[model samples]
Structure formats: structure tokens, C-alpha cells
Target: MTSSIHNEVIIFSQAAGDTIHILDLYEKNRKNTKFSIYVIKNKNIYDYFNELDLRLKNLVFIPYPKRFGLYNIQLLRKEKKRINSLFKKHFINSVNHKIYFFAHVYDYLTMSFVLSLSKNNTVIFVDYDKYDTNKTLPKQFYHVKDKMLLTIYKYLVGKQLVLTEKKAIKLLFENTNIKSNKTDEVSSKIKEKYSHNIANQSTGNSVLIFETPTAEASIINYKNTMIEILNILVKAGYKIYIKPHPYKGFSPFLRNYNVSICNANVPGELINTSGFNFIFGINSLSICRLAIDRYGSIYSLIQLFTFRRLNEKDYNIKYLLGQSNEKILFINSLNHLDKILAKR
Candidate 1:
């Protein structure tokens, strides 16, 4: 008897964090598998992954369209034809092979292409953030102007979804139409592969701050609040390092503060968290993830600032962190943060 090979295709268009998820999937299934990756290029995400040591041979980068609406039907058609051609070239006689698609939910071009190829394939939506399904599904199904496109997306997805956390599986079942049989969980095994081997007894006096793109979204005065936090950390005699968000680099004003800056291209999850006594962020999924893995004392500074526009997704960080067995703290005020530092 001989084992059968699995043909898997992954399509994604998101931030550097998503690339980490895709890498995790590839690392797990690379052996005895025919893999093809299609990344809908957005910003420096492609460039960041291209520089990684993981030599993905069949990686395909597709440039995202500037406009993808009714006015650009010709452009859409051209892109669709190109994608179909690429699929045909990559998976010859795809009907005979059982093709599985692990994809993110956004990006019209990639989703449309996946719909075309999904007639004889399995399409599983990969949600990097476990709490995102509720927010994303509503926007796609209700708000999208293209009813045909929405129908195609829904039909292809067909109740299959993948999440990074196991605890979120019940939440998905309770909230969505996705059945328990079709919902799959892929743990963040990439963290284990790259995590530092620090002793359980060691507790350092350094802090690592994971920056978010709140400033880019104009949600809050990110720079001023960051400066305030930096000052508090400095006065408490703690070494500070800030990991700039992959998509949004911090303002130059942060340079005036006494803190070392990390490379913006690297994923926060990939960084070693052993040396730090504290890992801080404003509702960053990276913070919660590292905390769950018992890397450091993770903290969220979400209460210290207020967003101009409210987003439900931003509020889920606390909920997710609460599920962790480890103690993940939330900083409510600068004074409260000072008190915690004093205790430390």
C-alpha cells in the first residue's frame, strides 16, 4: 500500500501576521504535499516574506488591482483570466486531484479567483484572528454591493473555516452557521519553533512594546500616548524596546523618547520574548498570543487611550486574553501603570 499526496493551495492578502500563519501551515504540511501559494500583494508584505529563510518554491505573488468595482470590469476580467491560466498551469488536470484552498476572507480578486477554482475543490476560510468571523461575515454578506460576488464567496466558503485558537471553536459554532465537523483549528506552532529557551525562574527588567496601527487609522493620538508610556517606563528603571507595526511605522517623535526601535518588517510573534519582563500593546493579538504561550507578563494599554471611531474588533482583545490561563494584565490609567511598575 502507498500513501496518497495532498494538493493544497493557500491564498492570502493581509498583514505580516497572516504570513506567519501561512508559514505555520506550510511548515506542518510540506512533507508529502504539493503546495501552491498565491499572495495578493499589498504594501511590503510580499517583500517581507520574500526575505525570509523559508525557501517557498511555488510562491506566486499577484499584484492587487488599484480599483476593483463595476467601473473596472475589463480589468477584473483580465485578472481573472490570468489567475485561471496560472491555476491551470500549476494544477494540471485539477479534477483528478483533491485540491484544498486555505484562504483569508478579504481581497476581491483573490476570492473571485478562488470561487472559479472551487467548483471541484474545498475552500476553507482561514481566520488569523479568532474573533474576526462575526465582524467579517456581516460586512461581506450584508454590506457588499456586489450581490453576485457575495453569493459566490458564500457558496465557495460553504461552512468551512479555520482558526488559530481552539477555544474560539465553540464561539464560532455558537455564532455562525459553520458546523463543528467543518471547523478546524491550527495552533500557532511557529511560535514554538522560534521561541527562546528561557528558564522558568528568570524574570528580566526589560519591556517589549508591540506597536499597533492606531495612529494610521487616526483612532487616537498614538505618539503622545506612547511617549507618556515610555516616560513612565524610563522613570521606573526599565529597559524599553518598541517593535514597530509591520504595516505602520511609528512617528519620528517616538525617537525623542529613550527607547530602542526594532525592525518594522519582522512579525512580532517571531521575536524572542524571554528577555522581557513585560510585553505591552493596545489590544494587539500578538500580545495576547505571546501571553498565552507564557513568554512574558503581557499587558494591554487599551484603557489608557480612546479611539475616535469605535471598532468591535478592538474590544475582543480583552475577551481573548481573559480566556488565557496565565495572568494577562490591562493598564487602565497612567497612574495604575505606575503602581504596577512600582510593585515590579
Candidate 2:
């Protein structure tokens, strides 16, 4: 830990969902401790900040860099002082409090760039989803510029901490040690925000399928497979809800289905799912986040064979920890899924 540190925690967030996920854990821990929290807010999520709780909204200060980049020496020189000041001003007393970054960031190099600026003696990278865990990015970690940055990061920071059971570890290139996953909170707040009336709501037989960018990628036929799954569910009497990835927007293909498309202006993680009996998706990070619950039977559309594009990448690793002990199932085929649904 740093020499002049205090009982404070600073979080550097890239997305609203990741920040919300961190806050869920942080808020639970905050009740029992005297830790001050500040967030390095992502400019993208700032507009929705005011709508959140006043206490949560207050934590979203500590501005992100106006000019970005790690390889750009010009940008680095321009922002170094401001970056250092942001930390010194807010997190001077912050010592062993590890910075929490979602491990599933697309640009691992960019994440490393952020870490290079304010290295905690221990960086706690929280687990999120990645379609291709085995897909290695182009080797840019040991470049001359990166090597220079690495030395600075090491001098500023200490070790690394990962907060995933297993699947998320693949997204991390830097060496890290795993920490136990322990976070549980209710979703009445989410239901209130979304204005979902439980008394008027139907029986808990709804299903939410997250529409991801990778779902419609050229390498796969995820859309068609999902359509078939939805058809099966519709026939089996499951009220379906389709939630598209915010950045990807709506998909025209899903318009043909008998599902309600959520006009969600907020992060998908904040949507109430406890009212639903089953929540399912194809190894999506959002599903992974929501799957840690008792209200819904979480499922991964994990294939048992090389029949789908999901076979081309890493599917679900919940079995590694013990097959579905957490009530999170990984079904192999449509038939397997149907049988399970029939029993339910």
C-alpha cells in the first residue's frame, strides 16, 4: 500500500452496468465499514447519474480524462498532472482499497493504460463476460511504449486481485490472484425504478434474453437459434422479454418474434428479474451478473456439441465449480432445455 493512505476506496468505472455491479457489492460492505467511496465516472453514464439514488449519484465525481490514450505520448504528457491530481485530491487517504475494473473490457491494453496511471498496491479486477476467452489479442503488452508504462505502473501500484470464481480469469492477461465472490442484495429498488407493478404482473413465467453484438456477428447464427428457442418458449407458455445491448441498439430480426422489446434507457443490470421464474441467455455478461440470485433459475445456452458457433468459443464454466449447484444451469441442447422447462 501507499505510504500516506486512509480509509477510502476509489472506483474507476468504464460502464454503468459494471459500476452498478461494483456498487451492489460495495454498498453491502459499506454498511459495516467506514470507507469513503469515489467513482471515476465514465462520461457515457453521467447523463443517467441524476436518476440514481442521491448517495450513489454523489460518488460519481472524479472526472475521467478529457484527452485519452496510453501510446500517444503527447496525450500522456498533457494529462499526467491532471490524472495525478484527481487521485491525490480524492484518494490520497486510499491505501489498500483496490481499484475495481471489469475484466471483460474489449481493449485490455486500454484497461492497462488506466491502471498505469493509478496503480493500487493491489488492483481488484472484477469478473465480467467475454465471448472468446481463448481468443488472444495482438501482442502489444511488451512493446517499448508499454514496457515503459509497465515500469511506471509497478512503481505506483502493488499486486493484482481478481474477484471471479474462474471464467473471468481468461480475460486477464496480467497475473492476478482470485478472491472469493460474496455479494447479495434485493431487487425491489430495481422494480421501483422500472415501475414494474407486481400485483398486476402475471405469474412469474417470463424470460429475458440479452441481445448482444456477438449474437448477430457473421461468425454465428445466434439470432436464428434464439428465435427457435423463443418459439419453443412461447409454445410452452413463457412470456418472453427481449433486452438489446444498449450500444448495439435494436435488432430488426427480433421484431418478428412474440417478445416485448424493452425500451430500457437504463443499464440492463438494473432491471428487476426476481419477478421472473427463469432468466436465460447465451453466456452474456449481463446474464452472468444476474445469474447470482435466488429469485430466478439462471441458465446458459451452453451447447454440448460443435453444432453452434458457441462451440467456437468458451461457453460456461459454472460446472468447473460444481455443476449448477448455484441453480445456474448450463443446458446442452434445445431438447435438454425443453425437458427442464417441462419439469418446471
Candidate 3:
């Protein structure tokens, strides 16, 4: 270390809401005199992180227009040259023994530029490519493509960090064809378990965080389903709190229901502090895993919302995901929930 005065950590994403939580964590860490951080932003998603109280000696925000015009395949050669130039000017300067780049997802563009600037020193790669709810044809293509890109990513990046999920790990292996028996499963479990405990300790009627249908661009038949479930929970005489997906925007469907819709950003601390039982959407199994000790997967509920069939492979996936056979709850609708609950 050459008494380096500046250290930079660039986070690449347009979705500031999720990444801000990571930045908040970095801000709270113990500070040393050796390194300072410059929080780089692309697409101008800097406002969310700016609001946080950070003790870092310096923070630099860089925002640029995403290469919207270059989405066409025919323009990639020209686009590649232009992108290279921009990366050299803006992103390359941040690479040093004192500097690091935290690529949020398997963004090929960001990763490519980082590799070009990479030397023998410090470059920390953080991969946070969680599942997306959008089930569109175009997005599906991108998802498969991203898998291949991420595999290549594991080799080039100085460090590969992933969330503790078996499906994600399997996907990475399938995409990258890289067999590493050394793959580390870093758990965000502390946060999740702490929140679970908080929810249990709280005194009040339980809150039910609903995964809205229109997450990403796909629509699930949620209106009727949520209504059906709420009626049962209401009849059970439990007060309900409802929280929607952040990107799904405000839900009008919840207005007529007996549930209270929470519109603000409810942090993990609050989720831990507040008592709530999760009523899952078809795709909300992941979030519910963070809440309770166990989860009941309604395979029939999946059939109710999705036209796609849930086969043995789907159950195998769920089983591989740490859920036992008994934990899987296959029900047609809320009406069937009463019979299931009675048996429980």
C-alpha cells in the first residue's frame, strides 16, 4: 500500500432501492485511515444512497445515460467502441490497489470494463443477481443469456460473492460450466432470522405482506386470490397488514379489503420488529423463507395463478431448496385452506 488516499467502490444498477441497503451496511462498518470510498452510479440512481447517513470521508456520485440506443444487435460494434471509450474515461480511473468495483449483478458491460482495467491489486466483485419476477419472453431470453455471462464472470472477477441459495448456485454452475467445490454460500441469514424473531416478539395482530401480481411485467391472477384469502383470515378474526412489492406501485385492490396497505419503505429492522404472517404469491416463496421457520408451498395455488404446470421437477426444485415434502402445501384456493388448516 502506497499511502493511497482515495479508494473507490462503484455499484452498477438503476434500481437504487435495493442496492441502498448494501451501501447502508458499508457505511456502518468500522473505518480505517487507509481507504476512502467513491460511490459511482450509472443511470443517475444516486438519490436513494445520498439520503443515508454515511461516515465515509468522501463519496463521489457518477451518473450516465444507459446505452439505450445501442440495444440493437447490428449496432454493437459501434456501441462497443463507444462504450470502451466511456469506460476508459470514467470507470478505469477508479481501479487501483486502493480502489475496488462492486458489480451488483452479472452485468457483462460493467464486468468487461472492470476486467479491462484490472491489474494485480484490489478489485472486489459483489454479485447480487437474485431472481426477477418478470416472466416475459424477452426477459426470459435475457435470463438464460445472463446465466452464460455470469459463468464467464466467475473466472474473470477477483472475487465472487453470492447469496446463500441453492438454486442460484446451481444456476451459476449450469451457466458457467465452472466446477468449484469451493463455492461459498454466504447467508443473509442473520438479518432474516433477526427479523423473524422481531416479528414474533411484537404484540399486535399479524401483518401479511402480499407479493403483488404485477411484479416485473407478468400478471398473476392475484385480485380474486388475495380477496379469497383475506376473507378467511378476516373470519379467523386476525387483524391484517398488507405490504406490496415496491416496483408494483400502489395497489388499489387492497383498498376495499379489510387489510391495511403499507406504502412506505419497510426496512428489515421494521419487518423484524413487527409481527406479520406472510401470505405468499406464487413467486413469493423466497421472501417467505426469510420470515418463518418453515413455509407451505401451495402447488395448487401455483396452478391457480399460472397456466404453467407444476410437475415433479418443480417439486424437486422445491425439495432441493431445503423444503421437505410435508412443508409443501398444495391447495386449489382459500376455500381449500380451511380443510388444510383443520387437518393441521
Candidate 4:
């Protein structure tokens, strides 16, 4: 269903769970106009939003979580119906402003629902590349099929407002004609030109980002992976520093690691001027490229576990890791990590 008038814009995102903070910034920037966010909740979105104080005085955030996990077609259809119902209940029939729908993930279920309900509305796909680092995928959710869905969504969506050309290349080149050489050339140039404005480095201490299942399904084994990475880097005389993926939920487990955790408020100026190296989970492409241009490597523990999870006969871990050289140096199990890093 379309929004009532031409005066408002609503951001439609999956699980008001993760993106509320990001939307807060958007709401602030567009505060002059009537802007609302419709967050389709799957879990306990209200609790999460309340905990974070995501409720703003002007920006109306709707938490619409379904009671069931839509694992099959029947449930998916039901979920679609539920989402459509919410949009109609909230937006359709109003006449003051044109309604805009910003789809964040653009997955099949959500995409299908939006297409059906868009009837007379403007639909935009968010999740710009400036936000992506193209390093890793979340473990608890997401699948190869989602990648296919994203390809389709990009084709159908009105516009793609990516952060950087490098990110655009990464998204378009997933299975296209954009040559890796050309992409790398553009990526390097972008970093070189923009480094002065965006690049941040740590001068004295370094932080290792241990992103758990929250970062993506590809790199969920946080404990063993973190230990292996720390042990190897420690042996190499690197001091210990750790932080969670900015979007990852708070962890009591990290206390045991004796590390520091940071959030969105941490100034990019601080990271840019401090000369710190971010060893992180590559959920966003910008972070991966940033690390490569500044730190020379992206230490993603998830990549190691993902390789192990792949069918041994189907893919050679060493060869795959070797080919993905953008910011990756090596992917290894704990037993072989030291030996591999020794060679690097």
C-alpha cells in the first residue's frame, strides 16, 4: 500500500532489529519533512528498540514482528500478507504527501511484498555500498539465494545510491562483465584520493574485530577463531585489542577476552587520524578496502570457518583464499594458522 500524502517518506526495513540506529541519523537529516520508519519485526523488535531508546519524538517507528519464522512457502506467503496488511493499514488512502518506500535488504519475500504493495508508490532500495565492505556474510541468517534476490532487486529497484564506486563495482561484479583488474584499479584510486578525508589509523595500539554470527553466517564461530588469531598475532609481537562488529549485539563473552567494544558514535575522525589498524569482519566493503589501503590486511576469522564448512571435495580452501586477495592474506584453522601466517 502507498503512503497517504506527498509530504512524507517511510523507510521499510527488515527487523527494526539492526537498522534503527542508522535510521535515526536519516530521520535527523530529514527532520524538516514528515519521515517515518516501518520496521518489520521477526523477533522482539520493541524490546530492542526500547532498550536502545530508538523512539524519537518526531520519527514514528513501527515494529511489526511476525510470530512465526517463515521457513516455507506457506509461511512466507503468510508473512507477505502480514507485511502488506501493515503497509495498507498505515499508509494507503492518505492524500497529503507522496509515499516513498526504502527497501533495505531487498530479499525475495520482502521484494515480492513491496512490488505488490507499491501499486502507486515510489520504492527505493537502500543499503548503499559505502556501507558495505564485501568481506563476509552474516552466519545466523542469509544464503546464496539472497544474493540472487539482491541481483534481481537491483534490476527492479528505481535507483541504487551506493557509497563508493568501489562498492558499486563489488555489487555489480558479483557475476557481471566488470573486470577484476578494472575494479581493483578504481578501488585503489578511490582510496588514494579519499584517504586523506576518510582514512583513519591507530598509532600505538590496534584492535581486532571479532564479529560473531551477527556479522554473517559465513563467519559465526567467534570463540575459536578469535583465540587462534590472537595467539598468532601475539606470537608475532602484536599487542591484544578487540572490538565487536559495530552492528553486532552486545556480548558478555567479550569480557573474558579483555577487549574494548565501540559503536557508531566513535568518531571516524578518531579512527582516521589515530593510525589504528582495524582487524574486522568484512560485512561492509568500505571497511575491507579501508583496512587494505591503511593496514595492508583484513583479518577475518569468519573466512577461516566458512572455508572449513564448505564441502571439502568441492572447493580447495587454499586456492580460494589465494584468489580472494583484495584484503585477505590467509584462511586457516587453529592448527594450521601459525604455519600459514609464518609463510605470509
Candidate 5:
């Protein structure tokens, strides 16, 4: 069958970050290659994938069941064969298959197992969407349980935890690194969709808010917590705007408050972040890069919440991610935000 010189099969789940960056890489570096994207556990966000750049035609979804533990190499082989079958379904006839992943902790597990199937094939890792934390698998998962899980995943996969390049020695121990900083393509598209001028959006004191529903299990007083932020902003006489996560529906609030919802596709980074005094989120990692870029201070309330439903390891991961990056400030309470804002 006639095809591009190289055939790449990218294993990614989320449409927003990693997948978008992969498209950006393909757009910038037009290597003569045909490719397909394999999504893991994509049932919920299947609709969200459509919003990605229209270049990729074939998107295959492979759900990871909880029963198949991390150490199951045989199960992984079975999954890869299913993926091969998926390739057949798509009639993707190219032996030159190089699997690509963004190399976050969990998705790395999926991509590594897939890479193991083709032992000789090259596996590429990108750090497009992951938060630039000093933390990674080894550092984050130093505890016995997580360490054992990561170890088992590596052992079963058999492929080395190769990061981006020679300069990214730190990421060798970590999971991801700064590879391609091409969030522009996706950001531009989002901006075009929104088309709201930054000046128009922010007339006076305003702050952008992000609500991560995925992390709500760990968040103790979800509604009250959101209300608390809104209340604080209201008392400070700040006009509040919320950009609800695509997965997490907007939190319900009485229309009496000045708080409003943003339906635009604009990412926090794309927005004129300088216009706002502060940016707030509940464990939403997407805005870290933007927070770093803009002169304004960014804060997170992840540590303020309780995680009764979530495991201790998972809860700790969220806590660490808050203080992990210098760009974002992790506050345990709304009261703490006053001092930081005072400095600003």
C-alpha cells in the first residue's frame, strides 16, 4: 500500500494538551509520514477529540480496564494485538510504526506497554502539556506503593524511560521535559473561536478561574470552595469569570453574584493574562505555563480541599503539584491570598 515514508501511532488520551502538541509538531515538522492517534479511555471525552486540529483523520480509542494491573505484560501484549487489529480496521498498512507519548505518569504507563510490543521501533516522548514541575515519577512516587507500581510498569514494558535529549538529564529521573513549546496552534484556534478582546473582557479588577471536575473527588467542599473564591473576589470588588473545564461542567451558582461563565474555547494562556490581577484554579495544571508567562500572580486551592474518596498517594500528588512549580502559588486558604496580592 502507498503511504508516507514513516508511520507513527501516537498513544494519548486527552484532546487538550498532549494530542494538540502532537498535531503542532506534525504541522511544524512536516516529515513525510502518515499517522494515527490511539486514545486510552476516551469514551467520556470522545466528543472533545473533534476540537483538535483537523489534520488527523484516524482516531482509535482503546479503553484500559482496571482489572489488568500494571505488571501484566501478557495483558499488554494482548492489548497491542488489539491495537494491531485496530490498525487493520483503519487499513493503516505501514510496518514503520513509531509510537509516541507525552510521558506523564499514567499515560506513560500506557505508551510504554504499547512500545514494548514493537521492541525495535522508536518511541518518542513529548512534554507539551504537562506542568513544569520539579516532580516526576521517581520523585512523586518515592513511596513504596507507587515506586513498586512504577517499577513493575517499567519491568513489564522493558523499554527504558528515555526523555527528550542530552540537556534534559533532569527529566531522565522525571517523566517529561520541555520538548516542543508549540501551544500556539491550539491557542490560536481557541482565540479565534472566542474572538473576545482582552481589553473588552477586563474593564477593571478581574480574575480568571478554572474548575477541574476530575479532581473534585479529592476536593472536600467543592461547591462551598468555589463559592468561597467567588465571595472573596466579590468582597475585593473583582469581576469574576470562570472557564469551566470541558469535562467538568460549570459549578452552579446563584445569578445574583457578578460571577459569569466563559463558553469560549480560549485557554488561560491565550487570554490577556496581564489584564487580570490573579488567576485561580483547583488543581488545574493547564494554566501553569500561562501563569508563568504573565506578570500577574496565580494561585491554586488544591491543598485547601479534603481527599476522603481519593487514595493518600493521589491526594499527596495533588498537594505536591501545587508547590512544585514556582510560577503558581499553592494556598491552603483564601486568607493566604491577601498577602500574595499585597506584594503584587
Candidate 6:
């Protein structure tokens, strides 16, 4: 059997951040590759990609069962069959193609389906979040059933799994049987394409805030605290813009404030953040990315609100911010936030 000269690239992405990373990969390999993106059915993600100028062909949307659980053997089997059918419809003779699959490592079902697609294919797992914060096996996966599933997943992927972070590579090496030599970081070509504009500096007195959905779980009145912060900025004459979480559009309460609402469909990292003087978020990875890139004066509101159940992930945001060469400030209280705004 003769193999096609062109490589077939399949991407399974969940959200805007994933889409940005996929875009970087697509732009780099669009020359010799036939690309197909399977977006996990999300209204916001679909809308975001739909608005892009690229007008990508072969974009497929697949439904992810709302109640899908890893341990549910029946559901898992059904889902696997459904996804397999989708792949069969898309690729008539995948064996004759050099297939490349890109997906998040944490998505076990998607990974399983990709593994079943083509035996000779390459699988690259992409994670946009901070590597130190993300765990391949979470605490919930400590159960016997979950452990068995993870073990099976590890074996199926074997040495084919490639991650974007060097820290993640180390973690996988230390935690799993996956060897360091087997895994590699995101290619320098893709990384260069993705971060080409990282050096763009921030200007003007406009402040961009990336809103988080975790506010509902906070001990303090999240709305009130946000309103107070907005009030301070407004009174201090700083133009404020709020980028709502894609999953949870604009908060109605925040509309009352004198702040512009950024298109929630767009990933915060993709936006031209250099237009703003400051960027704020409650431990958002976007803020961390911008901070590392030195796009603006980054600040974290994590210090203000106490969560009912704070975990390592929450603290890791702080660590990531600190890791950046750029100085990122932390707002400890309403008074602290006020003083910081005053100084700016």
C-alpha cells in the first residue's frame, strides 16, 4: 500500500485556549498537512472558531456526554464506539496516511478513541496550563478502579505521548512508567509561531481583567467585591475592560459598572493585551501567560477572596506568576487594591 505524501492532522480541542494552541500548530504545518479539528461540542468554543478569518475546512463538532464518567464501563464503551464511527466517516483509508493526533492528555475518552484510529499514528498531548499545577493523575484518580483505567491509558499511549512543558515531562517521568526520552516538549517551530508577539509592551491607562467562574465558590460576596474593585478603578480614572469567562458569559451585575466587556468568545491570551496598562485576574492562567510575556502590569486578586476548598491548583497560579521575570502584584485586600490603583 502506498502512503500519501501529505500528513493528516486531527485535533480534538475543548476550549479557546486549546484552539489558540491548535491554531499555532495549524499555521506551522498547513503547508504539507491536511488538518481536521474535532471540537468537543461547546457553544462558546464553536462561536469563537466560527468568527475566526481562517475559515477552516473539515471542522467537526462531536458531543461529549454530560454525565460521562471514566469508571462507567457501559457509557465509556458507547462513547468509544460513537467516536470511532465519526473517525471512520472522516478518514476513508487512514492506514495510507501519516496521521498526527493532537489532544489534551487528561481527556481519557478522546485519547482512547485516537489510539483506536490508526496504529502507526503519532499522538501529541497538549496542555496550555502551568505544568507544575497540573497532575497527570489527580487525587480522585487514587481509587483502584481509576488507577486501573489510568494504567491502561498509559500502556495504550506508551512512548507516543508528547507534552508541551518540560516540567510536565519531568512529572510524567517521576510519576509514570513513561520515560523522559520518550516524551518531548512542543516543537521550537510551533513555540516560535505562538509567541512571536510576546514582546509587545503595554500602553495607555486601560486595565484588562480576566474574570474567573470560581467566584461563586468564594466565601466573600464575589459580586460585591468585584463591584468595589471596579468602583475604585473607575473613580481613579482608569478605563476598565472585563473579559468574562467563556463558559460563563458576562456577569449581569458587572454590567452596571462603567467597564467595557471584551468578547468572551476570544481567548484572553490571543487578545492584543499590549493595549492595556494593567491586567488582573483571580489566579487565571491567562494572566500568568501575559505576565511571563511581559504584556502588561499583571496582578492577581486571589489574595482577596478565600475559597471554601482551596487546593494546590489555586496556589500554583501564584507560583507561576512569581516564576515570571516580570513583576506581578498581588492584591491582598480592597484597601491594597485601592492603593495599587492610586499608584498607577
Alpha carbon deviation, residue 36, candidate 6 (Å): 1.8
Regions of model 4 farther than 4 Å from truth: 1-7, 14-32, 40-66, 69-81, 94-113, 126-204, 214-222, 233-242, 245-253, 264-275, 282-286, 292-344
Candidate no. 2 TM-score: 0.58
lDDT of 1: 0.58
**Error at 230, model 5, angstroms:** 1.5
TM-score of each: 0.70, 0.58, 0.55, 0.50, 0.60, 0.72
* Candidate 2 minimal-lDDT segment of 10 residues: 161-170
lDDT of 2 at 276: 72
| Model 3 global lDDT (CA atoms, 0 to 1) | 0.43
lDDT of 4 by residue, 81-101 (tens): 665675466655543433333
Error of 3 at 172 (Å): 9.7
Give the least accurate 10-residue stretch of model 6, judged by summed lDDT. 164-173
What lDDT is reached at residue 159 by model 4? 28
Tens digits of per-residue lDDT, candidate 6, 232-286, equal 8888778888888877666677777777777777677676765676789876656
Q: Which lDDT tens digits does candidate 1 get at residues 1-344?
A: 22233454444545565666676666777775556665565456566666665545466567755565533557656655665666566544444223333333444445445444455455455544444333323332343444444444343333333222211111122333222222233365666674433224235587888775555464566667778888899889898887877766766676777777876766777777867778888766677666677644788787787677666436554455643333467787999899888887
For candidate 6, list the clashing residue pairs, or say none: none
Q: Give residue 116's error in model 3 in angstroms.
A: 3.6
Backbone clashes in model 5, listed as residue pairs:
none
- Tell how far residue 224 is off in model 4, in angstroms: 2.8
Could you say which candidate leads in lDDT? 6
Model 1: CA > 4 A from native: 1-13, 42-45, 66-104, 127-129, 132-189, 195-204, 216-218, 310-327
Which of the two, 2 or 3, has more lDDT? 2
lDDT for model 6, on a 0 to 1 scale?
A: 0.60
Global CA lDDT computed for model 4: 0.41
Q: Model 3, 1-344: lDDT tens per residue?
A: 23333443443433423343344335444364332344344322243334444454444554333553323544555555555776666555453443334433434455454455445234444433333321222223445545554444343332332322221221222232122231122245534532323222335445455455453233345566557766776676556765555434346767777666653334322244234443444544334333234455223245344333335336434532342223444556666766554442
Ranking by TM-score: 6, 1, 5, 2, 3, 4
